[model samples]
Target: MRRKVMRTLAEARPDGLDPVPGGVRAPGRRRGSGWVAMVAVAVVVAAVVTVPRLWMDGRETTATAAGTLDVAAEAARRQVPLPEGNYWSVTTLISAEESAGRYRVTVTSKTERFLPRDPAGFQLLAMTGLHTRPLTAKDAAAWRAAGSPRLCGDDTDCENDVSPVGRHRYTAMPSLWPLDDSGLTLPLSRLVELPVEPAALRERLLALWPAYQERMKDWPPAPKGAALPTRDTWLWSLSLDLLATPVSGGTRAALYQMLEDLPGVRGLGRVTDAGGRPGAAIAMGGEQLVVSEETGQVLARQDAAASGRVVNAVLFQGAKWVGKLPRLPKGCPKVPVRDTDCVG
Candidate 1:
C-alpha cells in the first residue's frame, strides 16, 4: 500500500516541475538559483562602479606629482645671471583708483653706465605724458642738437626726454596697470644667485650704497613744501635695501624685515604670485607698499589716507646707441605756473 501511494504522488507532479528519474528538488531550491544570479549581478555592478573611482584617483595623483616636478624644475632653471654693466631706459605707467577719478602718472628713467662724464647716469630725465606721440625724426634731431636739456628754449621737450633717441631707449614699456602702489624697480645686477644669504647681499648693497648715494648727491632736490620728484634717484635709494636683500624661493623675507626696520614704516606684508611664490609689501608713512612679483622689483608707491598722493610710472625699451644725442625740435610750450618752479 505504501509503494502504491508513492507511485501515485510521483505521477501527480507539481506545476512547472518535472520529476527526476532518481532525484528530488524543492521549490525553494529553484528560487535560490535566481538569488545567486542576482547576487552575481550586484557584485558585477559594484566592481564596475569602484573601478572608475580608483582610476580617477590614480590619475590625480600622477598629475599632482607631475606638477610638483615641473615647479621644481622651473625653480632650478631660474638661475640669476650676473648683470653686465649695461644701460637701460625704463618707463613705467602708474595708475591708482581713488575716490577721485583715476590718477595716472608716468615716470621715465635713464640708467646708463655710471660714467662720471655722462650726465644721464641713474637719473630720471622726464616724468610727463607717456601716451603722447613720440617725437618726429626732424624734431628729435633738433632737440639733440640743442644739448638735450630739460627744456628746448621755453618748450618742454617731453618726447626727447621721455622717448630719447639712440641708445638710451627702453626695451619694453612695463605697465603698472591695476596699480598696486608698492611696486619697485631693481637693477638686474642687484639680483644674486640663490644659496647666497640675505645678510651677504645686504652687505654688498651697503658697500655699493655709498657710491650710489654719492652719485645722486648732485640731483636736484625736491623744493620745500612741494612734491618730491619720484625719479630714479629718489626711488632707487628708497628701494636699495630691498633690492639688496637676498631671496629664497623668490620670497624676500629679509628684505621685508629691512623695510619694516626703516624709520617710518609701521607694517609689512608678503606679496605672492599665482603659484604662491612669496614677495613683499611694505607700509611706510601711512601708505600701502606694493612690489613687482615677476622680477622681485618695486614699481610705484604712494601714501595712504590723509596724506598726499605720489605716483611714478615708466616704460622701458632697448635701441642701438646713435652717435651724438638727438636734439629737441620746436613744439608746444609747457603750461606755466606763477610763483611755482614745478616743470612738467
Candidate 2:
C-alpha cells in the first residue's frame, strides 16, 4: 500500500515541482516532496491558530546596513490573524541554475497549492509558466556562440523534439498530505500542538532527535569516523523546515527567535530575492532566509555556494485562505484519473 501511494504521488506530479532547500524527502518521493505535503498539512494546523507573543530575549540584536529595515523586529511581531475560508492557498516561485558545459542555465517555475480546510477534501497542486534561459550575460553569449542549441538538461520536462520552456501541469490529491520525512511522519494535529515559546519549542524539537537517529541506523553506514552534526545544527535545520511550511505567524516568530539563538546566524539587512522581491535576509552558513519587511512573512529560502552565489532558491510569494480554486492555465486540459485534477 505504501508503494502504491508512492506511485500515485509520482503519477500525480508530472510537472516536476522542486522542493524547498534543506527539506528531507521520503524514499521513492521526489527530492522536495516533503515540503509540498508539509504546507498542505500546515493549513490544517492553522485551523485553531493564534499563539501568544513571547519575549525576544537573551539574544544580541544586530544592526542593519544603511537604508535597511529592521526585519528582526518585524519577525518578532508576527501574529497574523487567520482569515475565514475553506481552503488554504499558497503560491511559490522556484528558481534554480545548473552548470551546462561552458555556461549555466537557469530555470524558474511557479507552483500554486490549494489545500482544503476539510481533511477529506482534495488538495490542488499546480506548476505553471516554466521558463529556462541563460544564467548570465556571459552564459547567454556563450550559448549564442554555440549555435543557440536547445539546452535540455535534467529537471526539464521536455520530450523528443519538444522544448521545455513554458510547461504547465496540475494535480489533485485525495487526502491531506502528511509531513513525512526526516524520520518524522507528523499530521496536522500533531504540528498544531507544538510549543510557541522559543525554549519550549526547542525542547520539543530536540526530543524528536532520538527517533531520527534510530531511523538512520537502518541506512548504510557513514564513512569511518565521520563526525555527526551537533545538536544545534540539527535544531537549526529542523526549525527552518518548519518555517518553510504554512505555519502560523506565532510559530514563525518563535522559529525566528530560535534561529537567532543558534550560532552562525547573521542578519544580511535588506536585499532582493531571486524573485525580485525586496526583503531582509538572515543567513546561517550556506542557507539563508528572506522575510517581508511589512508582514514578516518568509519570502524565500536560498542555498548559496561558498562564494555566496545562489544556486537554488524557493520564493514564498504568498499564502492565504481562499473560498475557491483558480481555473487551469489555458492550453491545458483535465485528466480522467481518479482523485486527481490536471491543467496545463
Candidate 3:
C-alpha cells in the first residue's frame, strides 16, 4: 500500500476527510513499477491496551503503570545509525479493514522499497507477502457460522480464499527515484539534509505550504472551488508522513518535539500497534501515531472514525541504507528487461 502514497495528497487533512486513496503513481512511471503509499488500518482497542515496560540501555528498567511515556526523550534516544549503502531501503507492514457484506476483514501486506542513491538508478519495490482475515476472532466465528461464503463470490474470489487464512506474494516492477508529484516532494538523498532542530524544521516545512496549496487545486476530483486546509493541518499531516519516512534519528526526534508543540496534540496513553508492539500513542488533528517507548521509532499511524474504530494504519517495520537491493527469489516472473515481476 506504500504505493498509494501519491494517489492522494490530502493525507491526514482535518475535518474528517479521508486523506490517502488507493494506489500510488509516479509521473512517467510504468505500470506495476510499485510506488509506496501511506495508508493502513489500526486495531487499537484501548480496553486491552496496557502500559509497556520501560527499557534503558537494552535493559528492562521499570514498568510505567501510568501509561504515560516521554515521547521526545525516547525519540532522542533512538539509535538508528545510518548504514553505509548505495540505496535507501524501507520496509513496512500495511493493514486496512474493509466491509465484506455483514462482516469486516483485515487485509495486511508486507512491502519493501529500495531507492538507489543515484537519482537515475532504478528503484525497486517488492510486495513480499499479503494476507486477509476476519477482523477478529468473533468475526471469524460468525463467518464460519454463516458457512464461510466468499464475499465476492464469482467476482474476484476475495483476495485469497474463503475460510481460515492464506498469504499471497506478488512481483513488482522497478521504478525511478525522486517522486514526481505536483505538490511538495523530497528526493531520497534529501532526507539526510532535513534540519535536526525542531524550530528550523518547522520553518522549513512551512515554506512548502504555498506550493502544496497551489498543487491541491489541480489534484484530480477536487471541486472547482474548495477551501484548502490551514497551515497547522498541513504541517501536522506532513510531520506524520515524514516520520514514517527514512529520516535520521535526530530528525525524527525533532519531529516528535515539533508535534509536542503543535496545538491539539496530546498523549493517548499506551496503545498496541498492528504488529502487536506496545507504543506511546499521540493524537493530533484526527490522526494518531504509536511510537516506540524505547527507540522512539514510529511503530504505526492510525486514522480512526468518529466511533473510535481504527479504519486504516501503516506500520513501520524497519528502514536503512543498504549496499544492494535484495535478490529476487527463484522462479520469479522475469520481464524482458532487468527487473522482474516475480512473486515470492
Candidate 4:
C-alpha cells in the first residue's frame, strides 16, 4: 500500500510597537521615568531581535534532521526482500535532449524463483551494452568466434548481418550484455554507513532532476497529463537494498548513510508529477533517483549524466523493475532487393 506525506510552512508575525494610544499626549513624565522607559524599550528590542535569530537557527537544524531521518525511513521501507519466487524487471530510457537522437532502449532481468537454485537466484543479474556504442572489431571477432555471424564489412554491416528476419534469430549471443557477474552491489553496500545531512542531500537530489528531464526529450512524449518518472526515481529505490544492514535497524540506517556519503551530490529540485504529488529528485555521480511523495517510492533511476554518453536507466513498480536496452526492430522488407535494403 502507498502512503502520502505533505509538508507545509506556517507564517510568522513580528512583534513591535503598538499604535500610540488614541493620539493622546502622555502625561508629563519625570526625567527619571523617561530614562526607565528608554531602558525598558531597549531591552525589548534586543529580545525581539536575538530571540528570533536563535529560534530560526534551531528550526533550520530541526528541519535538516527531520528530512534526513525521513529519507532513511523511506529507504528502509523499499529495501529489496529475498525473493520467495522468481523475479523479473524491465527498464526503458528515452533521451532528454532533442539533439541527442530519436532512440530508446529497454532491458529485462530474470532470476530463479526457488531453493537449490537459491544461490544463483539470489544473485542479482543485469543485461547491458544494448544501448552502448556500436561494437568494436575485437568485440565482433569475439562474437564471431563464439558462433555469431561475421560482419559483411564494419559494425553497421555486422548489425545488418545479424538482422533477424533475413537471418536466424539465435536464442543466445556471447556479445550480449554481461549479466553473470557480481555488480556494483559492494560499492553500494558501503555507501549506507555514513551520516545524515539533509542540506547536502537535498542539493544532490536537485542536481539530477534536470539530467533526467534533459534525457526525457529523447523519448516520445507521454500522452498529455502523463509524465514519466526520472531516472533517479529508480536508483533511490534500488539503493534501499544496500542500506538494509541488519545492524542498521534493517535498512533505514543503511539508507541514511548512503545518502550522507553520496559523492558529488546534486539536487534536481521539486518535480511535479501528473498524479498531483510532489516528487523529490537527486543525482549521485552518474546515477539518478526520484522519490514520490504519494507512494514514498523511487519511480526511476539510470545513469543520466555519465560523460554525456550512453547509460542505462531502470523503472520500478512495486516488486517489478525494468532496465533500458537498445535494440532496433528490423525495418520493413524491401520490395526490390538493392544496395539500400533498409529505410528510416
Candidate 5:
C-alpha cells in the first residue's frame, strides 16, 4: 500500500522506498523496525499470467465505481492536448526528504527494460540509489562534537555522522514496483491496454480503482467531504504512476486528458526545469509539476513555495524498449526466491 506524503511528498514516502522495502533505516539492521534489504526480483515469464484482483474490503464496488466513472467522464471531457514521443526514457529520480531540520537527499538513476511478454512490467536496470548528507555549519559542528566517527553502511568514506541519523542507503535494487502481477494486482497491464480515449481510460480506471484503493489503505475511504480521497487524488495518483512508469505515448496522453479535469491542478504555462529545459507546468497539493510539452513526461515536482524548492524531481535522460533483459551481474548470488539477500 502507498504511504502518506510529507503532508509534503515524503508525506507520500518517508524513506521514499515504500514501493520496495517497508521503511528506509540506518545501516546495519534495527532490532525490530521490520527493515528489509532486498525486495522480490523478477525472472522471465513466458506465458501471460491471468490473476484475479483481490479487494481487501471483499465487498463489491460496481455501484460506487459508477460515481468514479462520472468523475472520469468529467475529467475526460476537459483534457487539453499534450503529445510525447514513444521511447524508453531513462531518468534520474531525486528526492530531498525533510526530517529534524535537515534534508536527506536520495538520488536514484535507472533505465527501465520493458518486458514484451509483460507490456506493463519493466525491469529497472543499471540502478544507482545513493544518499548524501550535506551538512550546514551548525550541523557539522554538532556531529563533530559528538565524535564524527561512525562508518556508514559498508562505505567507510561515508561518515555516519550525519544530521538525519536514521536514513538508509538503497543501492542496485532490481525488482518490480508492485512486487509482481499476481492476485488483486494494480492492473497496470490492463490499464495500459485501455484505449487512450479519455472516456475509455476513465472506464478502465474506475474498474481498477477499487483494487487500487485497496492498496492505498494508508488513506481512509472517501468520507462525506475529505480532500485527497476525492476523485482528483484518486485519478491524480493513477496519472502520476503512469507518467513515472515505462508506458506508452497513448497512455501518457490519456492521463493528461484525465488530468485536465483536476480543478486543483492549474497550468502555470511554460517553465524551465532545474536541468535548463523548457516544459509546460502545473500545480496541485502545494506541489508543482513541469511536464514536457511534447512527450507528456513529468520533468519535476516541487513545493509551491516562491523559491520552488524540489520535494522530488526527475530528469528523463533517455528512453527506449529492449528485446531482452539488460544483464545480470557476473556471478550475482542467486538467492532463493524468497531470500532477502539481494541489495536493492
Candidate 6:
C-alpha cells in the first residue's frame, strides 16, 4: 500500500527513544516510529474496487504559525455521523501512566485476500527475481487454499507446487508500513504543559520542527514559507509526539481542534470498518481516519489498499488518565521485534 503523495511533513519519534540506527530518535531530534509496516489480511472473499486517495494540497504552516481554532473547535462541537461498511480496526496504541491516565489508540486499515494473477501476482513475485517458472492456476488455487504460501521449505513441496503461475495474490501490506518511533514507549510526563489556546499550541508545536529537520537525513526539504514541510506531515509528527504524552485533556482537545483546521481534512460522513465497527471518518491523503464523535478521541487510522479496501488499519480503543502504566505480560509476541509495545 503506497502512501498517497502529500506535500511535506515534520517528523517526530515515538516516546522513549535513543538516537541510533533502527532506533527511535532522541527528543529534540527528528526520529522514525518503530513500526515500519503493520498488517492483517483476511481470507474472506470480496469484490475488488480501485483504491481512492482522499487528500489534496493544503497550506503548510509552522508549529509557530498560528491557525484559526474555530475550524477544529467546530469539529469538537459537532459529532460527525459515519458510513455503514464492514471494516477491520486494530489496537495501535496502549499507554499506561503511573498515577496518570492510560491512553490507547486504534488504527483502521484495509487489505485483500489476493491480487490479480497474470500481471499483478506475477509481477509481485518477479520483483523478488527468484521464481523461475510461470505460476499456474493449480498453483494459485493451492496457494490460496493454504492461506497463501510462505516460501516452501525442505521436505515440503509448497514452493514447487505453487511457485509456478503465481499461486496467491500479492498485497502491499499497508498494516506493516514502517515508522521510526513505532516501538518507543513514552514516559508519563509532558515536556511542558501544552497550551490550550490554539495559536499558542500551534506555536509550541512548531518550535519542535527544527529538531526534526536536524534528525531527518534524506527527507526532502520543506516547502518555502512553511516552517515545516507539509501540514499533514507536521500534524502526523505532532500526533506521534502527543499519543501517550501526559498532557491535559484540554491539550488533547486543542490538538484535535488544530487538526480539524488543516486543509483537506474533513468529516468522513459515516462508514463501518472491516471489523464492523461504525465510526465517523476523517479523510486526508491516502488515509481515512475514524474518530469518536462523543469523546473526540481518535479511534482508528487506516490506509487505502490498492484493491480499494482499507489497509494498515489500527485502533486506539483506549486512552484514559491512569495511575500507573500497565505491565507487559511475559512471552509477549515478538513478531516484529522485542519491544514494550508488542502484546502478542
Report lDDT per candidate. Answer: 0.30, 0.56, 0.55, 0.31, 0.40, 0.36
Model 1 lDDT tens row, 21-88: 53676543332222222222222222111100010011111111112122222342353533333332
Better of 1 and 2 by TM-score: 2
**Residue-wise lDDT of candidate 6 within 20-55, one digit each (tens)?**
666654553311111111100110111011122323
For each of the candidates, the C-alpha root-mean-square deviation to the true structure, in angstroms, is: 34.3, 11.9, 11.8, 28.4, 11.7, 18.0
Stretches > 4 Å off in candidate 5: 1-90, 97-116, 119-126, 129-192, 211-228, 245-247, 301-307, 333-344
Global CA lDDT of candidate 1, please? 0.30
> How many clashes does the backbone of model 5 have?
19
Highest lDDT among the candidates is held by which one?
2
lDDT tens digits by residue: candidate 2, 1-344: 11112223434554435364435543535233222232222211221110111111233435332223345435535655565476677777666554445666665556667766665566676665456677899989987886776644223323411212365456665434433344334543345556777788778787888887777777787689664545766676666556645566666766777776676576677788877888888765556677777777778877655555666677787777787776666543332124554434
Stretches of candidate 6 off by over 4 Å are 1-187, 217-232, 244-246, 306-308, 321-344
RMSD in Å for model 1: 34.3
Evaluated at residue 186, the lDDT of candidate 2 is 51
Best by TM-score: 2
lDDT ranking, best first = 2, 3, 5, 6, 4, 1
lDDT of 5 by residue, 142-240 (tens): 445545433232122333211112332112222333323211233334434556776777776667666655666766666774443545655665565
Clash totals for all candidate models: 35, 0, 14, 45, 19, 84
On the 0 to 100 scale, the lDDT of residue 124 in model 4 is: 25
State in Å the error of residue 332, model 5. 2.5
